[model samples]
Target: MTPTLGFFAWIIIGGLAGWIASKIKGTDAQQGLLANIIVGIIGGFLGGWILSLIGFDVAGGGLIFSLVTCVIGAVILLTILQAIRSKK
Candidate 1:
């Protein structure tokens, strides 16, 4: 499964997760496809890290879990960015 879920899978999952997150965060209008993909991948990493800190087993989680993690992280990331931008 690991081998099958390669770079392309990451991109697909990230893109979808990011798109959903952007919509959820109400920032979809401000982002492009590339941005979504980037955010999603980064968000996935961030989410995994955060969940791991709280003793969540993120690694063994399946596709849906991974997508949820990515979406959660993307929303958090977007919220932080929005807050920072608003302060400016």
Candidate 2:
């Protein structure tokens, strides 16, 4: 069976995923480590969800796949956030 990830592991993954997403979204300058972690975790979830809806399984794709899905999700999140901010 695959080993379960610990809390720190999740944080690390989340931070990296978030940072990459922020950079892609052009919001890196406005965010920090904490924000990255938050975005990453949430993005991972959203990414996995979206991918699953599209008949993809990012969760089973390993590290690189995980990053890709997370990045996709983070970008989507940032896009929505930017749109909302623009409207306000």
Candidate 3:
């Protein structure tokens, strides 16, 4: 099993990743700090799972890799959400 990141690590990394993802997706203006953090945390989980499924080792990849993973996941998540919302 991959070792889990600590609480503060999650917050910091998640916030950064989420903020970046939102900016990339053009949704930054619609989200606040708390929302970014939450997106980041969830995006980390989603990213990790997707990477694992693709046979990538997500553990011990260090901070930069983790952030990249989270950003990719968050972008994907935001894309999906945007699509769904647009369809409504």
Candidate 4:
């Protein structure tokens, strides 16, 4: 089934995913709402791409799966970001 999402849907997904990412990466207080949204959106793209590459299709739900996938990706991204930042 094809999923139909609206602007608010995206916001919800981004917020939840980003929050989860921040909590996982121990950066919840450091990153604000806007930053979370941005990271979450980017993480969504990254997650979807990675899933597709592995032959996994994730485009059915409204913001459930999307949020979960994005959170996972965001966590990974944040981890990488932290690692990189630590080196500098």
Count of steric clashes across candidates, in order: 0, 0, 0, 0
| Candidate 2 lDDT tens digits, 24-83 | 889999999999988987887888888888888565678777777777888898899999
lDDT of 1: 0.86
* Highest TM-score scorer: 3
Q: How far is candidate 4 from the true structure (C-alpha RMSD, Å)?
A: 2.5
Q: What is the TM-score of each candidate against the true structure?
A: 0.92, 0.89, 0.94, 0.87
TM-score ranking, high to low: 3, 1, 2, 4
lDDT of 3 by residue, 5-86 (tens): 8889999998999999999999999999998988988888899889989988899788888999889888989998999999
Question: Which residue pairs overlap in candidate 1's backbone?
Answer: none
Off by over 4 Å in 4: 1-4
Model 3 — TM-score against the truth?
A: 0.94
Q: What tens digits encode model 1's per-residue C-alpha lDDT throughout 6-86?
A: 799889988998999999999999999999999998888888888888888887888888899889888888888999999
Number of clashing residue pairs, candidate 2: 0
* Superposition error at 12 for model 4 (Å): 1.4
Indicate the worst ten consecutive residues by lDDT in candidate 4: 1-10
Model 4's TM-score against the true structure? 0.87
Instruction: In model 3, state the lDDT of residue 82.
Output: 98
lDDT by residue for model 4 (1-88), tens:
1224577877778788888899988999999999898888778878877776787767764467777778877887898899999999
